[model samples]
Target: MPYMGDPTVSIILPTYNRLAYLREAAASVFVQTYDDWEMIIADDGSSEETRAYLRAIADPRVTVLWLSHTGIPSIARNKAIGRARGRYLAFLDSDDQWRPAKLAVQLDALRVSPDCRWSYTAVDLIDADGHPVDRDGLAPWVPYAGDITERLLWIHAHIAIDAVIAERRLVLEAGGFDERQRFGEDYDLYIRLAMRSPVKVVDAPLAVVRAGNGENYSANRIEAYEGWVQLYQKHSATLPGKRLRAIARSRRAENLLILARLYTNAGQSWAALRTLLLGIPGSLLTYPPWAWRAAKEVVRACFKATQRRI
Candidate 1:
């Protein structure tokens, strides 16, 4: 199966006020080895600079869409998915750029595994200057291959947005990304997708993820963890009652640990204690050991926070 239709891929990019990196991101898409694709970048509440920059792009395959501020990434993604008309959909973050052959390689992977409805490739961690975050090694995702669902359940979180490519119909069936979700919507969508269908790995680093200090989104870890809690709650009912309950407990425990760490980082001892108290119910002995380990880290973070001047 080479490709299903006239255009094999629809690269869906959701952006906010990230004009500084938008051009590079767009340039990466235009340079793809595979030509049968369209790039749909939906801007959610951006400044005039972004609008002008988007207009400056002359490629016929690249189109810009502007909409009001939704304050949620999922909403912006939903807007892009609505206008997409390709057999396969790939998501790219605004602040991230893909490798030159990213789309081409991933699309070929899908072609080989036509039965796989969802797939992701590896990614490199880069800094604000677009340099590698680690010179000695790649991120922990490169080794991922074969049956991913069972491995994903305990192997941490979302593999990053840039590496994902899925059949358009499968994405629609999974209800798309939950626009109502404010944080971790990417994880929400990915987990649901894994539960529904098997996932394939391209086994290549297809994108560069900008990761560094003082970042706007990554700094807000507590909020992102809270959003993860909401996601599990929202989807628990969709599966068997027993599995839902188990996952819910695990998600809650994980969330509580994050809240504790956040309070510790803020140098609020009492706040950290409260956060731990919240974790107790979810961190019961019945839950996984990872939650317990996270609980200990939170405790240390709280103490370290107290040693600092307030």
Candidate 2:
């Protein structure tokens, strides 16, 4: 179906070297029940084959921008956002796909809740082969809507990047994606957006996310840790009230425990121990369950002999 008049949503797709999955991602958009949408594919210096694949796309609604290889996805997304001419902006990473009703349902939800400018849906995880991976994909807290900022600060929600759709002004107001962030860019943007306005959720899994692909940015322990630290430092001061601040501290402690696990996985037992120690004190007050689990995991892993771990 051809798009008529102006599009309601501008889909920002930033790609690196993931050519194999790019076509599938675009196909998902083409099948959307909502016809009024534009997809901007930002080619961040992919190979000639990937470039050719993008150039072959004949859809007028799909605009492809070729740029020099900039390792940051936020830069490519920013370029797309600059060129977008839509009331709402949605993100679809190169390696992810969405359900046909994703746009229509989200748009309807936002229409009913006029005050909520942003919304995200649950997600399904797929393996490298595009096969369904029945892991604990969604967050424990589901179907959360209206004023979820406090809940966001404390727990990890299943809001996938491609699953989100937000008003153009709100996204820009949140300063767009942090260009300097090599990781956790989405987390930072969503947190900031929630701080300003209430965000809603679609409740159902409307997105298919590719995880454990080995090529993903989250695989980098050091960069992931840096991103967590950056998040803590950036948002810690803005949290209102002592309770929220304590929750923020617990979140930081949780991140440290994750870092400790990463260290333990890499056979850096002493480093893991040090990281766990740093988090232990705050974990007791903010969230004891995560703290205890982290401690047990870190200790168990620290005892293992040094070996190359994935």
Candidate 3:
């Protein structure tokens, strides 16, 4: 094992079956203007293609490790961190790629602000095909502060793990990533990190996130929001009073609305109706368009129940 004592960063790229995308993502990493870095590609149980592709990379900075299939991203990420040997740990999803300047600029930001333990850059939302996304999905949270501790509780406005770079010690002290969470693990990790210290942001966007895949995690909004609600419940003890209670109420509505859809998907319309009703007021106030849609579903379910009686 070569001691990369002077390397600036270790980027963890986790892949399951994305051989072609992983190849492109790897190329992007090698092309970075900032030369001193290590890229560890943690390959979860993948097809023979990806297993073979991992063997073909020539870069000395790149190291590929294989593990059996595990659906939990947090676990795979934690495994990668265990293998990391950099002063700073950056994350780049297998399907995503970064601009050449990403490491250089983000390092400058982290260097200038010694008090901030973690920093992230903005990112471009692209399609599954790697084409630029027209929709401004993550742009809403732009120009946010270097110190963003309290603001992280409400919602996960930061979507790109590629944008984030955390000090290795800080990443370990923050407990790294949660291994148990099936959904919204990134959100939970960010909240915990923010609570301990400030999360800084670079205004410039340096990475591109693949979007528009119907199978993407965010597609199941209900489960993700429910997980968010649980995250708050689990961590509320460490937070302030009103903020804690309000987050529960706020996240509860989001969870219920998602649960309503989940119930509907499971063909439990009545259960869905109950959840929609319980979730409405809060959702109406917080998630207007989505809550509005849930309200319509509630009315539809009520009429369907009346018809069943007839």
Q: Quick one: best lDDT, which candidate?
A: 2
lDDT scores in order: 0.75, 0.83, 0.76
Which rank order by lDDT, best down to worst? 2, 3, 1
Residue-wise lDDT of candidate 3 within 133-161, one digit each (tens)?
Answer: 88644347555664454556655456468
* Candidate 1: residue pairs that collide: none
RMSD of 2: 4.2
> How many pairs of residues collide in model 3?
1
lDDT value, candidate 2, whole model: 0.83
Query: Model 3, which residues run further than 4 Å from truth?
Result: 1-6, 136-139, 270-310
Estimate candidate 1's alpha-carbon lDDT, on a 0 to 1 scale.
0.75
User: Model 2 over residues 24-111: C-alpha lDDT tens digits?
Assistant: 9999999999978899999999999999899899898999999999889999999999999899999999889999999999999999
Work out candidate 3's RMSD over C-alphas.
4.0
Model 2: what TM-score? 0.83
Error of 2 at 44 (Å): 1.1
Candidate 2 worst ten-residue window by lDDT:
301-310
Candidate 2: where are CA atoms >4 Å away? 1-5, 136-141, 264-310
TM-score of model 1 vs. true structure:
0.82
* Clash count, one per candidate: 0, 0, 1
